[model samples]
Target chain A: MKPKSFAYVRPDSVEEAVDLLAQHGEDARIIAGGQSLMAMLNLRLVEPSILVDISQLKELSEIGVRDGAVEVGASVTQARLLAWPELKARAPFIALALPWVGHFQTRNRGTVCGSIAHADPSSELPLSLRLLGGEVVLRSKKGSRKVKAEAFQQGLLTTARRPDELITAVRFPVGVGAEGAGFREVARRHGDFAIVAVGAVKVAGSIRVAVGGVADRPGLLELPAGGSEAERRQAIEDFAWELGGYDDIHASARYRRDLVRRLAPIIISEAA
Target chain B: MRRIERDEIVSVSFELNGKRAAGTAQPRTLLSDFLRQTLGATGTHVGCEHGVCGCCTVMIDGVACRSCLTLAVQVEGRRVETVESLAGDEDRLNALQRAFNKHHALQCGFCTPGILMSFTDYLGRNPKPSEDEVREVLGGHICRCTGYAGLVAAVLDAAREMRGETEPEGEPHAA
Candidate 1:
């Protein structure tokens, strides 16, 4: 399948990019790496009249610590982030999961912020951001606003970002003292989308388990750290039931729930 | 922000296989089609335009990426290396290609170009990759024939040859 022909523009600055967005509104789409957006376009799933390319914006390519988190800009590709020397110290879970985002080929061209912008329910970046308490920085001609990952991701393939907004960056908070995080997923193949993915982070005697690929959106559940093995298993099982997995071609509702029940504890225990 | 109209044809210029190349394309033309249809470099095959099949893989600025997922204009002024770049000195097969021939890595030869391009990039960065690491990278491609056993052997063999190590006993020399 070929994409429907569309106008293309490469803006030199973030302001110009947002200006283009405000000018075109719903008719224009912002493209960073064009890894996911181009695939959607090739499938003809999206037919915007124009595409604003922002991969060349130098202002949006920073990967430095800001406030208390590592702010990844829109132009920071997945391969770039993984190559950052401080990635393991700043965000170990992301480092562990980045290799699973795609193959070496796609990761070279896929941006970390682009994945958050896409907000796929089964994607590793979204689930990791949600569990680690991150924020998405959105900009437009009007102004800028920061939305937490929980509120930013509305539902399946939907986000709180407006048509005129450009996701300039996403902030993943730096790991605090002695905080341990772990991520695991079961997919049909290593590089394929996960059938069920689980992530866990332990801090100050509490553990948070996040589940993806089994719900309309990635979701998180919290439980105390010192519970008995059986108690922890029961709590995870109840949380799995609450998620209410549905049948799909890849996995059944019951099977997804079972994976959650099985995977949550292992991840939590590993994090602990 | 100057926009190219949907129907406007623009000259997309890039360095292909160590030479300057230029082609005209619409804004939506994929790099794979631009290379094949416009530049006549058909070694880069397109199996699935959506980036899953990994058949359209090529190198941009020394990194492997799916040309089908990249627009022709996006690679403007960039250096692109397709399967055509692998051969050397009167079109002799490269070390990886020789290993693949020794190991019988391909039965249909459709996915070989992408796989060879990937290995070229991979071996440059990691000259001593383990078998599992080779398989991990090879997993990105989907090959129906040869069952991947030969592919794994070829990659490991190629890695040894690139590392300048002597061949083991009774191992056939990769031409």
Candidate 2:
């Protein structure tokens, strides 16, 4: 289906794009890769008056190491991020969940920040980022601020981002100590959005489990390191209660809650 | 809503088949529709408009993208090559296309173009992808027919043919 008519602006610089977005305010949308926004537009979910095309903004489509952390530009495509050697070594959880993203063709145009901004509860990237304690860098004409992934996503398809702001980059802390990561999700079909997805990271002798698709937003649980099996089981059960799963066409709320109770311990055990 | 006037359609210029081309497109027009309906390049098909099905896949600046999910105007000044441009004007099928035919990889041929474009781009990057890598890359596509065994074999066969390990035989000519 065709999308509603809108004005298009291809901004060559990030500053120009930011200015355009600020001018358009809520009526404007920044499109990078256009993988998600295009689908939404065609579905008429978002009918913005102006589409600020930031694909040409070279400054926003980069991946590099800075201060011992892998900093990925917001426009960095999922395909490129998976192929990035640094992400594999520095942020292994991101690497593991990259393949589960929508098939190869979609990943070619889907951006890392775009996924986070879209804030799909079932999306692997956002849950992985949250588990890794990633921070999103938001910029606007006024100033720039950083928000942790945990606090960034407020609800399903919701974020802390303002209408005029743009997500410039996402930063992942490097260095590993007792840190292992595992990602598991169940979907009706390969490449389909997950019915339930879990990402776990063992760091600093503690295990962090983030559950997606089963809640309004990704739910995270932090367990004390070197815990007994009984303690781990209790933690998993408690985490399930905290998750408060919701029912959808993919799975029932009860089913999701049960899966979390079952999957969290498994992921945590593997990561531990 | 107000009617969209003709002047509202913007002229988007891009490189198609290595030649510069321009077209008037509305903001809502998808690249796949623009190619097939507007430019008469039927090689790119629309399977799932949501980008799940790769049937509308095309090489945009060497990366496989679902054209049905890409806005035509967004690709201005970029390079786009559909199946029509995979082979040169000489009418010779590309090695991947030939391998697909040689291995009988397609049954209904509905998802062939998208698969071909995706695998072509995959092999371009990793010329000798292992069976597991082939599965990993091809997992992005969904083909109900052929059970995907022949598709995987076709990709492997194409890799071998590209490396001069095998000769093309009884290749299915594009219909």
Predicted structure with the largest lDDT when compared to the true one: 1
Please state the error at residue A111 of candidate 1 in Å. Answer: 0.6
Estimate, for each residue in A1-272, the C-alpha lDDT of model 2 and write its tens digit: 67887877777788888888788799988888777788888778998888887766788878988876678897789999999877667777777888998877788889988888899989988887788777899999999999988889999798999998999998877743236877888888768888889888888768888999887888888888788989888878887877888877778888988888787777877788
- Candidate 1 C-alpha lDDT tens digits along A175-235: 7323887889999878788999999888788898889998888998988878898888888
Model 1 misplaced stretches (Cα beyond 4 Å): A176-178, B167-175
Off by over 4 Å in 2: A176-178, B1-7, B170-175
Q: Which 10 residues in a row give candidate 2 chain A its minimum summed lDDT?
A: A172-181
Question: Worst ten-residue run, lDDT, model 1 chain B?
Answer: B166-175
Every candidate's chain B TM-score: 0.93, 0.89
Q: How well is candidate 1 docked (DockQ)?
A: 0.80
Q: DockQ of candidates 1 onward, in order? A: 0.80, 0.43
Alpha-carbon shift of residue B104 in model 2 (angstroms): 2.8
Q: Which one wins on TM-score?
A: 1
List the lowest-lDDT window of 10 residues for candidate 2 chain B.
Answer: B1-10
